[model samples]
Structures are given as C-alpha cells and as structure tokens.
Target: MPLTLLPTRASYGPGDPIGIELRGDPPAAAELSVWRLGELVHRQPLLAGAQQTLPELPAGGYGIELEAAGGTVARTAIEVTTDVRARLRYGFVASYRPGKDAAAVADFARRLHLNGIQFYDWAYRHADLLGGGEQYDDALGQPITLDSVRALVASLRAVGTASYGYAAVYAVGPEEWPAWQQHALLRPSGEPYALGDFLFIVDPAAPEWLEHFRDDLAASVAAVGFDGFHLDQYGYPKHAATLDGTPVDVAESFLTMLAGVRDRLPDARLIFNNVNDFPTWSSASAAQDAVYIEPWKPVLTLGALAEVATRARAASNGQPVVLAAYQHVYDQAPAEASDRATAFTMATLLSHGATQLLAGEHGKLLVDPYYVRNHEAEPRTLEFLTRWYDFAVEHDALLLDPAIVEVTASYVGDYNDDLDVAYQEVEVAEAAVPGTVWRRVTRAGDGLVVHLINLVGQGDALWDAPRNPLGKTGPGELRLKFVRGRMPRVRVADPDGRPRLEDVEVRIDGDHAVAILPALDIWQVVHVAL
Candidate 1:
C-alpha cells in the first residue's frame, strides 16, 4: 500500500492547527510521529481512514514519519513557522535527474534551509510546456520524463519545499518558431528578437500567442503540480513591432499576462525575472508575487549589489526581492578564494533583504544557463554555505524584514569616517571592497541591525573572476547614531554557525555610541536595541 500526505496551500505557522489527508491504502494499524531535528515532538496511533490534527508546536522545522508495524513507510517535511520573512530563503535546483534525485531534493532542503526551490529547465518545452509530457528533452537536451518531474515535486513537497517551474514568458522553441513568426517581435528594421539560438522572442500582445501561452501555463500547472512559475526574460527588445507593424510595450504586455495568470489561476504564484535590472519598475506590478532580478555587468561593487536589491524592492512597492546572482568564481578560483567571494556576495545581497538563487541540486554553483555547465562546489564551500544559510534562517526577522532602512555611514576617501571601519592591510576601495568592511544598517522590530561583511584582502567587486582570501584586516571601531531611550544593548552574529544574543557595552558620546567591533572574519551582524 502506498501512503501519501496531501499538501496545503500555504505553510503552517507556530501553533496553527494542521489537518492532513492521507491517500492510498495503508496498513490497518500504523503509527504516526512528528520529529524536529531528530527529536520526536508529536506521536499517535494512525487509523487507516481517520482524520487527526497535528500537535501544536513551536516555530521551526519538523518532519512526519509514518510507520506500519515496525517499518517506516513515509517521511514528510513539515515547517512550523509562517514568518513572512522566511520567504527570502529560496534556492534554485536544476541539475537533478528526476526520479534518481529524489534524495538530492531532500538534501537540498536539509543542507540549505531553503523553503522554496526553482526547478529550472525541467519543462518538456518552452512553448508546449508540459502538455501531458512524455519522454522529451529539456531546453539543453536533457531527457525529461514527466514521471520523474512528478516524483521530484512530490519528494520536494515531502521535504517542505515549494517547487516552481521555470518558463520563458515570450520564448518559443525553434521547431515552433517558424509557425509563431507572425507573433514574433521584430526589431526596428524587422528581425526576430532571439535569445541565443535556442528560443525566439514572441510578442505577448498578440492575442493568438497570448492565448497559447496562457493555456500552456494552465495546463502545465495542472499536469505537473507546480506551486508557481519562474518566468524568464532576456532583458532586450523592451519595445518591439508586432505582426501588424504596430509597436508593443513589452512591460505592459508582461503585466497584462501576469495579471491574467493571477485572475485565471488565483492560487498560482508568479515571479518574473527582470534580467539585469531592465524594466524592474515597469514589470514590478501587483501581479508579481516577488520582484526578481539577475544582475550582471554594470552592477560590480558590493554596495551596488545592495543598491540593486534596495531599488528593486522600492519599485515593487515592498514586494520581496529575489536576486539570481550566479557565483561563477568556483570554476576560476581556489577553494578559499571561492568561499570568500561567495560569502561576501551572499552577505551583500542578504544585507539588502534579497533572496538568492545560486545553489542548485547536488551542491553545484550555477555559472551558466545550461545546468550541465555548472561547477561542483568545493567541500569547504558547502560547509560555509550551510553556516551562511543557517545564520540567515536564525535571523530572518532582522535580515529579511522589508521595513528596514539603510543607514550606513557615507563613504569618504576609501574610509567611511562615521564607522572608521576600513581595511587594516590595504588601501580602501569604494565598491564591494577588496579591503574595507562593507556595512549596511536596518531597523527591525524594536532594534537596529548592522550587517558587516569582511571583504578584506579580496580583489575585484565583480561576482565572477578569481579573488584572494581575507587580508590582514582585524577588528576596528564601529560608531552609530542612536536616539532611543536607555543604553542600546548590542548582539553580534558571526559566521561561526551560532547566533547567541550577548549584552555588549558601548561608549556613548552624546547621541552616538562608539564600540569596538570584534575581529572580522567573513560576515557578522550586530543588533542594537532601540
């Protein structure tokens, strides 16, 4: 007898009543138990056809294991926290080989603390979608079996991770591009806009094409059971000519399609990729569940990383921001160099309240669009990532809060005088430093958070390229302006894998508090009570 637990629309919150349905025939007598981090939290005897409520629990992660007689039959991941901030921990997975990678999916959730996964390049085709998928090759020629996709989704759900299907909004495969010529967008001089040689761009405004895309999306949702979609774009041809030689505004057309999707499938989740910040504001309509951007070029400095995320969130009217900042250093640099670069990059984005989509299934760093081109992350890199992910989860309330404000001291001559936080061994740089400490400040709840990323001894601010390890920089003085009553209690969260709140004393000089920050390593967060 196969056993299954029905999925819910949204994640459960602490103490929320959970009523789950079990499908398929189970043993006449069974035992059900809920475990969190290895400790059993709830347990009861299971009757084949009886309904029951999960035990009230604290906010964190839990797992449900069903056993028949003495053998374990099923294990389901259950998240007990519904903090909206938790949504910022999304990770992308595309390298899995479907049914063979069910364990990999569970490993991803367990290792990264990711609450959601972007099942990239898992569709049958960009145009046809999963129109009752058979054995079809994905965009990159990877054989895709619909049964494998379904199994992967089921496994991910059992591990408490939401699955999102990846789809290009205006793309059509070459085989169908000829038929979609009339619906294709034309350049000023009349040329079809193409994204590489794989897919051609189509005009979303064309009613015929729009209907096809919409229908495919709906059919895909029903066929594969995707929690949402990761809509992709190439960040070009913002405005193009239609079949009738009429100009079409791409952003408006995108918004129309997104709004239409919401109306047609109100329960569907939508996230559009604003490639390299193009049309971020124009596309950040209410229709989008989150504003997503894949920053490249022009956005080099670490400060600029924060700026990009901050700007996207602002444009989206407070919608969550997901930055698909692919870390390409793993293939070009040593393990230590890659680890430092990855940590800085992640810290910079998280400091600005942005979710990341870099790691995929099997601990691979997504460097190229083709999942096959990704590099296997180093062992140490995975360890650091685990620590980084855990820290982010522990402080989601502070790091992911959208209401936070950026109050970092202004940069001055390679040294921000306000904090006196600069590199000790090398010259200070303005961007995501190869030397200086990158800092961002924000207010959450009754306290303020100062995120300090140690970029000391590192070279270049670009996401890709080789860089050195932490330089000779040590602890430095940190000063901030505080106006709340009572002396501010300070706490620090380092990349040491733990976030214990400690009472820190500061020298109050009038309205400012002067404190000596601990020696820098990679990333640290200082919380000041308001």
Candidate 2:
C-alpha cells in the first residue's frame, strides 16, 4: 500500500497550524516537508496512523510532500493568507484543452502567485461569443471543448483563482459578418470598418447590437461559468462613421457599454483594455474591476514606464492597475537578454505599484495569438521568476499600498529628480553603480519607503529591448534631515525572497538622519522607520 497524507482543509491562513492525517502501509520512516513557494520551510518524520500538525507559516501557498525511503509518494497544496492588499497577479491562456491544464492549476497558483487569468481566445467566435456548442475549434483552428473551459474555470476557482472569459466588445467574425453588417461601423468611404480580412467592428452604440452583447455576456456566464469578462477592443477607429452616417466616439461607446454591463451583470467582473492611454478618456466609469493597459510606443524608457503606470493608477480612482506588457523572449532572443528584460520590466512595474498580465500555464512565454506554442524559460530565468514572485507576495504591504504617494526630491537620485528639485535639507549619494539610478519615495506604514530601480548599462530605453545591466556592487549613501533625537532604523529588502533587515548606523548631522543602503539590484526597497 502507498502512504497518503490528507489535509483537514483545502486552505489555511497564515499563522494557522495545518492538520494532516497520515494513513496506509507506510515504510518504517518517512519525511514530510512543508514547502512554501518552492522553499522548504518545515520538515519532520511522518508517523503512520498519526494526525500531524504542520507549524504556522507566513501567508503564501504551500506544498506538502511525503517522501518515503523509495521516493516522494503523495503531495497536496494549502494556501495561507498573509496580506491581501496587493493587486491580483494576472496571466493569460489562449488554448486550454479540457483534461490537460486542469492538473497544472495549482502549479500556477503556487509558483506565479496568480489569482486571476485572461481566458484569451477561449470562445467560439468573436461575434457569437459563447454561442459555440460544447465542442469547437478556436480562431487559430485549435480544438477547444466548452466543457473543458468550464472545468478549467472550476479548477481555478477551487484554488481561489478566478477566470475571465475573453471577448471582443465590437469585433464580429467574417462568418457571422453578413447578418451583423447592418450593425457594423462604416467608414467615411461608406464601406464597413473591417479590422482584418475576417473581422468587422460592430457599433457598440447601436441599441440592438448593444443588447446582443449584453445578452451574450450573460449567456456566457451561465454556459461556461466565467467569473467575469475580459472585454477587448482594437486601438483604432477612435473616430468613425456609423451605419447612419452619424459620428461615433469610440471612448463614449465603450463607456456606455461598460455602464450597461454593470446594470445587467451587476456581479460580474469587467476588465476593459485601455489600449495605450484610452483610459484617459473612459477610466472614470465605475464598471471596471481594474484598469488594464497595453503600453505602446512613445512610452519607452524606465521613467516613462513608471509615469505611464502612475498616470493609469491616478485615473483608476484606487482600483488596481494591470499592465499587459508581454515579453517577447524565448525562441526569439538570447537567454541572457530575456533574463535582463524580464528582471528590468518586472522590477520597474512592481516598484511602481502595478501588477503584470503576462505569462501562462506551464512556464510558457505568451508570445503567439493562439497561446498554443510552448516557449520554455531557461532554468536560471525560471529561478529568477519564482524568486521575484515570492518577493512580491512577501512585501505586498509596502509595494502595493494604494495610499502611498510617489515623492519627487533630489535625495532619491538623478532621473527621479523631477522638476529638478534641488537638495536642501536631505541628500542621497550614489555609489559606483554602472547604470542610471531612479528612486520613488512613498509614505508606508509609519515609515518612509524608497524604491530604487537600476537602469544602468541597459542601452535601449525601450522596456522590451534585451540588454545586460550590472547590479550595484557597493552601497548607495543617503542623508536625510531628521528632527528626531536619536538615529532612525533603516531596512533594505530585495526580491530574492530572503528576509533581510539591517540597521545602518545613523550619524547625527545637526538635526538630520544619515544612513547607507548596502546595495541595490534590479530593484530594492528601503524602509526608514519614523
């Protein structure tokens, strides 16, 4: 007989002791290891016919493995809630076969820490939406079973992850384009506005067309059990002509559609794509669950990345910000280049309080439209990803604090010195780091938090470009004007998933507090207790 471990509950809160019951004809001795995000936390001998209690742990997903004399036998997953303040980590999937992806769900939850997903192209047709029967092939000609989609959604929900179905608000497939042609947006030349050879843009403002979408959305929820809808739109036809030769404002149309959905599917989650900066026009709507944006050109460079995300967050009115900044790594570029790009982009986004909407199941890079292609990440790159994700989970409080504000001062660094704010009472000195240094100051719980991003040696200011940048080799000096009597404590933390708290010696220069940070990497957070 095989040894088995049964967990009392599917999920456990941080600080809660997990209860497990072992059974079956086990070996003389066996070891049970409680691993949190791939790191072993607790290990103990497994006693047959005995109920065991795993020690309390920080909030995160954990895996319990039973290793016998022969090899590992049974495994289970448990989630511990630590801090839920950060925005949901989101990802995507284009092709999800039924019996497959189901078993791999926990891997995504435990590894990437993802709590939401964009079920990209999982529907039958762009126009018909969920009208496809139980079995159909997607636009990419990949076979997909509607039953499998529901199964996947159920499996994700079981792990506390929600699935959002992908649907184009205005796009209709060519096969269904004939009957809907009357509702299609027309061009100034009196021709229908066709997105591609096989798709046409429908008029969202058209009463009947709008009703069609609303009805289809509700039907999709009923049919596939999609928790919400991933509403998409082409970044075009900003201004266009309707079938009746009336001027159509795309932004207003989108807003109207969202409001309508809120009225209809009041409980459904809605995530609209603010293609580029379309949010500037329609972000004020109350129907969106989070502000989603796909950054385009003119917003290249690290500073620009921070600014764009900040701008979107400002417009979101406290809603979470998700960036669909896809990384075109793997098969396309060198492994080193891919690693550098991933580190830089992820660090920049998270440091600015934004969540990323990339990656997919099975450690695959989401590059193609179908999402069927599997681009495996290099071993070292995968390690970096796991560490970064775990770091985000651990430091969600300071990095994801919605109330924190970005302060501009000369003390931070050069690129961050907006308005050329000259130093007066406070001064931050730079080490001999190779790249450009940028810093963001925020007010964290009873402390001043400073985030450092290293852009040095990265030639192209473009966020997607691949290049190697050296990490800071020495400490960066900081001097602040402190009115407090004694030296203040300083803490430096990186996304290496390691707990690091060091008190830097603070020298009293009149009424100022001066401290030094050991080093900075792709990203680092410095907390100065008040």
Candidate 3:
C-alpha cells in the first residue's frame, strides 16, 4: 500500500488549523485516527485521492495512524509546538558569520541555541544598499543569489533554526531617484531630503512608489528561502510632499506590506524593527510573528527591558517580544560588573518572556573581520552566551508555558522615574512586590520547576518576599510548600550547578512550597519531584 501525508514535518501554534492528507490503496476501508499519548481523540474516513483538515489541537506530541483492511497500514508522529502566547523565544538578529565555512555559522547557532537567524545586510533593489552608489555582494563576498540564500536557509533548518530576511522597504535605488524625488520624505520646502547624502526615504504613501517597492520585496521573498521578513524602519520624520499625496499611515503601510507578504507565503513568519517610535509601531496591532525594538536611546536597564516586554506582549496581543539590546554597552564597564549586568539583563528578560537577544561589538564597531572573526574564534563571548543558551533550553517548558504561579517581590521602585529612586532609601519594614522581579512556577507531571529573577540593585533579596536584592530583610529561613498529597524529593540548582540538598532546608505546606535561597547575585531555580 502506498501512503502519503501533506507536510511530512508539520508544525503549528495553538489554535492554528492543520491540513492533513492521506492516500492509500483503493477499497482499503481504513479508519484514520489521531492519538495524543496513545489515547484516540480523532477518527475519520479515508477517501482515496482526497484530503481533510484536522481539528485544532493543543500543543503536544501526537501520533496519526491508519488501519486498513489488511491491517495497520501506516503510522506517523506529529508535534504541535506551544503557541508562545504569553512567552518568548530568544533569537539572534544579525547574520551568522564565523569567518569560515557555513558550518561555522551553524556551530555558533548551536552554541547559542538560537531559534531564529536574521540574514544581515541583504537587499534586492539598487537603492536598498549603498544608496545606489554601487551594488555589492553580501558579507560573504559573493553576489547575493537565490541559490546561496536557499543553501543558507537549509543550513539553518538543519540545525533546528528558522531564518528571516532583512530589508529596508522605504529605501530607493539611486537610479530611481527622479521617480522618488517628489515622493520622498522631504525637507521643509517640499524638496527631496537626504540622510547624510547617502540614503533617502520614499514617501510610503506614494502609489507608484509603493508598487515598485512591493514588487521588489515580493521578488526578494520568492528568490530567497526566508521563513519571514524583518522590516527595518529607521525612525525619522515624514516629508511634506510625500505626506500630502499619501493617505496611508506610514506604520499602516508597513502592515499592509506584511499582509501582502503573508498572502504570498502563508507559512512564513513576519517581524518589524521599531527604531525610534517603537512604542507607536508596537501599538498598531499589525499581524506579525514578533516585534523587534532597539531600545537604544532610553538606555536599557532591567526595568526598561521589562517594560518593553510587557508593552510588546500587550501590543502584539501576546506575540513574542524581541529586544535588540547591545551587549557591548554592558561589556565596557568593569569585567565582573559587566558580566553581572549582561547576565542580569538576559535573566530579567527571559523571566519576563522576551524572545530574542542581539550582541554586537562596541567602540569601533567591527563587522568585517574583528567582530565576525571573534564571534567564531573567541571563547569568552561564546562562553558568556552559552550560559544563557543552556539556561533557556533547560527551562524551555516553564519559559514557553503560561505561568502556573506568578509572584513579585519589591526591591526598587520604577527605575524609569526619579521619585521612585527616593523611595529606594525609605526601606519599608514591610516587603512589597517589585515590578521588575518575576517568578514563574510550573509543574511537569510529578515534578515542580521554578524560574526566578532579582532585577533590583539594592535591598535584601527574598525567596518568598523575605529579603530584598541586597539580602537585607525578610524570613531568614527558607520555606517549601507541596500539593500535600505526597512527599517528593527536592533538588536545587543555582546559575551554576546543583548543590547538595543536605545543605539547603525546604519546607512544605498544602499545595505550596518555598525554598529560602542563600545570598545570591542574579537568580535561582528549585526543582521538586513527587
């Protein structure tokens, strides 16, 4: 018997529909069934030369089996990933160039355990790169070709990662300058404006201009094997002439483009870079897989990262939140201080469920040789990122799943405001829930997992609202609570490795358990199994 199924390797977010195709021998009279962990949930007739769509299923591993007149004809496994509704999957934005073969890039991705890769500096039209001065190849020194991109994407998928293409939609080729002159974002006098004499922005509303841009973008998608598009809009003011003629909102125009792309490639993921007015772009509720915000100007802090995560989640209706924070900013400080800050930023963001983390060189930002070479050859930076990658993989269940138990501890006030700073000194005798701190507790079968973070700089840190970040006050002893049905073995791991349970004390109450952590710098997790 010959049998086939559509999308042999299928993936779906929660609530997403899935189309299943089955083909086999005639008069086979097969009973098609789908099972979750061996429990039959779905059954249907098998029609020759026909296909059917399966009902929406929850996120889990499922098996599809077909029983025919002869016997069990075929069985296949299907996996449905979690929707990531309230969670995030941290990814790397820049191109993966390890100054060697493509395998080097794959190695870096594996080391980082990245889920997504944004191909850096790829453009289709002449104006997209170098403002029409010259059309050059990509960072690989070879001309950007469809085959190259396909190979690149295949490599990424080989390592269990997704790929996204980067493009500047509003940019125009120098050869198209005259056509875009009046349609470009202009100066005060309605004349074509220039950005440092090299780059110019096309009025997003211009009909003809929009068509040309869309055509180029569509072709790029077809030529490149990208899982999605990363629309980069360098936040700048609109030109009067272009603004007057165009009725579509600039942000809305981008959304329209995204919709068009989705229409063309239904399975592809979509993302945007909100450079300056990211908040405005984020608020639009456009259909996108994720939102990327630079957060460059406001100076990223633990509080700032948390706010972005919250806002992005709200704006996207719980889509993944991605922040492109510069790692070098933290690296410039004292070695230990810089490492702590970087780790703190990553931990805070992960705890809050931010999706992606971007690291770039600072000072003389080197892209050609130094940064790329170091990214592949340097051990220190790789080790730094490896720590984060390992943490993300180990606790993917808690990170991706909705919070079973959410707790907040107060240490510092809103770092964004000044008055909150003054309250830092007041040191209330009572403990308050800190805005930046987050603890997500989850249960796997009989095992309990907790993900915790301390975002504040001062105050006695607490396990269950005991001490502040400074280890000052609260319950001196640790507490543990249980479901009360059965007693379970318990183990704990710091940011490092697991310690002896004998040294740590744990107490259990009905349906709740708490562990008093020793004085620590960043975060800790406790695991309990019954």
Could you tell me every candidate's TM-score relative to the true structure? 0.81, 0.82, 0.63
lDDT of 3 by residue, 53-82 (tens): 677777764555667778656544444576
- RMSD value for candidate 1: 8.0
How badly does each model clash, as a count of residue pairs?
2, 2, 32
Candidate 1 has which clashing residue pairs, if any? 77-158, 302-432
Over 26-73, each residue of candidate 1 has an lDDT whose tens digit, in order, gives 675788877543346778888646445677777765556677776776
- For all candidates in order, the CA lDDT equals 0.70, 0.69, 0.51
Candidate 2 residue pairs in backbone clash: 435-456, 436-456
User: Model 1: number of clashes?
Assistant: 2
Candidate number achieving the greatest TM-score relative to the actual structure: 2
The TM-score measured for candidate 1 stands at: 0.81
Off by over 4 Å in 3: 1-100, 124-135, 138-148, 173-175, 187-194, 238-248, 276-284, 330-337, 359-377, 402-492, 499-504, 508-514, 526-530
Cα-lDDT of candidate 3 = 0.51
